[model samples]
Target: MKTTLATIALLVLVLGWTSEAIQVQENGLSFSLEAVKRLQEMFESRGTVQQNPRSRSSSSSMCEDPMLPQELLPLCKQRGASASLARLAMVPMDVCEICAFAACTGC
Candidate 1:
């Protein structure tokens, strides 16, 4: 069991370190190398990935008429997003806003 786990870990490390871009798919799910690295860093730092000030995405840069859920408001604020654009709408625009928010903020 230990050996199996170790081998799996090694495989992941190898795949992740092989190049700047890592793409893998299994069981109909895909994973990104950048996301894997970020997760590993998050774990190593006890859930504290050093936040880069420049990486923070401002709300102004996000889509017009942002529609983030109330729960994500605090997280958005932490990531340097302004709440001025917040609104209550459920439309294609809201879906785009959610996707853009998740991608931009890495949530």
Candidate 2:
């Protein structure tokens, strides 16, 4: 178990070579270079899940409309299909108002 942990630690530390070692307690806590080499086998193995391509659809989604029930929706989002049409119809008026405001302010 200690050898396995030491291997894992060595694999994780990229700068372990430049550091000087010290024994705070004794030789009871130490990592073996042989153990680290054994753990390197994992990095040589092939990847399985990463090789597959992502799935996609070409058809237009009917989910373009909101799927929330009426009771769960907020006031602005709880409108019927006709309300959407009314908002769409207001676009020309909104543009006209902006034009009028800009003209009056010489903006």
Q: Backbone clash tally for model 1? A: 0
Best by lDDT: 1
**Cα TM-score of candidate 2:** 0.16
TM-score of 1: 0.23
True-structure RMSD, every candidate: 15.3, 28.0
| Regions of candidate 1 where Cα sits further than 4 Å from its true position | 1-21, 47-107
lDDT of 2 by residue, 1-79 (tens): 9999998998768446433121111112222222222222211232211232111110011113243222222322333
Clashing pairs for predicted structure model 1, backbone only: none
lDDT of each: 0.35, 0.26
Candidate 1 lDDT at 26 equals 20
